[model samples]
Target: MAVVNRRGAQRIRNGHPWVFRSDLERAPAVAAGFVRVEEYTGAPLGFALWSPQSEISLRHVSADASRAPDAAWWHEQLRTAIARRAPLATESNAYRLVHGEGDGLPSLVVDRYGDALVVQLLSAGVNAWTETIVASLQELTGCTGILARNDPAARDREGLPREVRLLHGDVPRVIEVVEHGVRYLAAPWDGQKTGAFLDQRENRVLIGSLARGRALDCFAYHGSFALHLADRAEHVTAVDISAPALARVHEHAQRNGLTNIEPVEGDAFDVLRAWYREGRRFDTIVVDPPAFAKNRNAIEGALRGYKDINLQAMRLLAPGGLLFTASCSFHLSRGLFFEMLQEASADSGRRFALRAITGQPLDHPELITVPETGYLKGALLEAMG
Candidate 1:
């Protein structure tokens, strides 16, 4: 059994899943995988995924102190995770089936695109149970295919090799999915974050509901937001830095039969600044940039980056227009995001009425105790002046 110090014991008991290397009092005798966990004083803690080489030494797997997780245990846990998302069938065919720590299966993320599933085994300990995990998921969901996307940087920290391979049948290069009656494509093999940003599924719906007049989707990746906005707005300008991405936006717009979307290739920051200076206004604007802060060290620069785009967006908002700004950076907390928006609003010299605060939809559950599962945060504001 692995032994944890008082700090680690308290942390796990308080519902946090990770036990750092500094908190481990003793290492397990066996290899990297499932092992019994105990307090330093010989009190049983639980069963955990033990990673010998990882700085995150242990990931709490179960509260049961006696038995290690077996096939049945994996089945039960996965069964519950799949069952919880049953209601999402009505909303979208593409969504998160398992949200890592949110689903109580740390370091394991599963996203579904129609009948195919894309899985990420992020930790060495979790990857050790690859066979059983895949078997359980197949039995529980009867998915047509399973793609193992183990190419994340986290695996490198666990001393594990990163590779993308098919764990099961076949996951196509691209899969079509429907969300709130809007159809889009998911590039499961090479797309960003398991084909697309499923976390923003609801936010796209929200933006569509408020879209009108001239709409702008800054950092418009593949035109997911633009497609939705096109259904409601008269015209939409989708801006991104990549010409290839803008090309895909055109393809997506064509696929959706949306002729109102104009794909523009440019850096969102420069485009927003120019638009603001030229007195260009939009009835609806969405600033969903990629994560600026990947780690804690980048938070300072990320805040500045966020404030800049938001300030530009606020200045470009037409009177009584709606603006939806978001950040997917976990290091940028919700409170910090709000504070940044407040500061951006102040600098824009624009009076704003906060409409709503948004986050991950129903399929992607966020626990207050485990903040890692909840990274996407957004705000809906109305330009009062």
Candidate 2:
């Protein structure tokens, strides 16, 4: 049994899944594998996947110490996760089938893009259990193929190699998914975060409903938001640094018969700044940048970047225009995100009222005890002046 210190035990009791290296009573002999977690006094706490090298030494799999994490156990856990998202399957063919800790499958994420399943084994624990995970996912979703998109940098911290491969069956070059009556082609193997940002589905629908006139979607990877906005907006400008991404956006627009969307290849920060200088304004603006703060040390710079982009976005919004802004950095709390927004609103001299605050869609559930699950923070605001 892996003995956890008092702090770790207390945290587990409170429903937190992570046990840091410092919180362990002593390092286990086995560096990377599953173990029965116990308190220093020898009381069985739970079953956890242990990774000695990583800061997150233990990821609790089950609070029931007696429960063995076998193939059947994994199947049941995965089945429950799938059942939870069953309702969402009706709305969109694309949705997150398993959201790591959110789905009680810590350190592993499996997103379903139609017949293909994109899996990310982000921890040594999950990496060790890849066969079981793949088998269970295949059984549960009956996906035509499982693509291991296990190349996220997070795996480096866990001493796992970054790799992308076909684990089972076959995957197409492009897969089509429909959300809110909009069709999009996603490249699960090539595109970002399992082809598309499934977490933003609800937010996109919400923003699409509020969209009007001209819309600008900055950091518009594959133009998911811009495509939705184009439904109501007179025109939509989708900007990104990658030309291929812009090209994909153009293709998607063409696929949807959406002629109003203009895909611009450029850095979002520069594009927003230049657009503001050009005195170009929009009725709707979305700023969904990649994680500016990779860690807590980068928080200051991230806040500055967030403020800069948001301030420019506010400046570019026409009177009564809607603004949907977001930060994906887990280190940046919801409070800090809002704080930056307040500063941006002040600097832009735009009086705005908060229309709604949003997070990842229902498929990506947030654990009340694990605050990090609430990583994506977004706000919808209406410029009053």
Candidate 3:
């Protein structure tokens, strides 16, 4: 059994899954795999996946110390996760089936894009058990194929190489999925974050309903938000830095017969500034930028970036217009994000009324103890001036 210090034991008992290196009494030289975690007194605490090199040395698998991390256990976990998301299947065929720690399967994420499943192994422990996980997903979803997108930056810290390839069956160039009556083509092999940003599924629908006249969607990768806004807004401009992403946005718009969405390829910040200088205005604006802060050290710079983008978005909104802004950086706390928005509003010199605060969908459940699992943060505000 791997013995943890009092601090680690107390945290585990309180529902926290991570045991950092600093919290350990004595670091064990066990191989990078599952081990039975116990208190210093030799009392069993739980079963954890141990990573000797990571700062997060221990990730609790189950409270029962005797529970084996076998195929049957993983099958049960996959089954339970699928059952939990049964309600979401009716609304959207494209949804997150497993959200790593959120689904109780640490460092493993599986996203369903219709008949195809995209899996991400973010840690060495999960990578070691990849075959079992892929098999379980195939059995549960009867998916035609499974693609391993083990290319996340987190894997680097785990001492794992970045890779993307087919694991089970054949994966076509494009996979179709429906969300809130909108049809989207997800390129799992080539696109970002397991094909698309499924975390903002519900948020897009909400902002879509509030859209009117003209809408601006910043960082509009493949036009997810812009396409949704097309249903309500007279015109929507989807802006991104990647030309390929913009091209896909155009293709997606054509697929949905959404001629109202215009794909604009450029840096979002530069475009927003130019639009403001040219006296361009919009009734609705969505500022869903990529993670400004990848780690804790970048938090200060991220806050400033968030504030700048939000301030520009606010300025672009017409009187009584709505603004939907979001930050995907887990390092940025909810309080800090809200505080940045407050500062942005103040700097914009606009009277804004908060309409709603949003986050990841029901499929991506957040454990109260694991705050990092609740990374996506969004807010809807009405510009009064």
The 0-to-1 C-alpha lDDT of every candidate, in the order given, reads: 0.91, 0.90, 0.89
**Residue-wise lDDT of candidate 1 within 120-154, one digit each (tens)?**
99988898999999998888888989999888899
Q: Which ten residues in a row have the lowest lDDT in candidate 3?
A: 24-33
Model 2: how far residue 122 lies from native, Å: 1.7
46-162 per-residue lDDT for model 3 (tens digits): 788877777888888898876768889999999999899999888998999898899888888999988889999887777878888888888989999999998888888888889
Query: How high is each candidate's TM-score?
Result: 0.98, 0.96, 0.96
Clashing pairs in 1: none
Q: Which order, best to worst by TM-score?
A: 1, 2, 3
Off by over 4 Å in 2: none
Question: Model 1 — which ten-residue stretch has the worst lDDT?
Answer: 61-70
Ranking by lDDT: 1, 2, 3
Leading candidate by lDDT = 1
Q: How close is candidate 3 to the true structure, as a TM-score?
A: 0.96
| lDDT (10s digit) by residue, model 2, range 231-339 | 9999999999999888889999988999999988888888888988999999999999999999999999999999999998999999999999998999999899999
Q: What lDDT score is found at residue 4 in candidate 2?
A: 87
Could you tell me the TM-score of candidate 2? 0.96
Candidate achieving the largest TM-score = 1
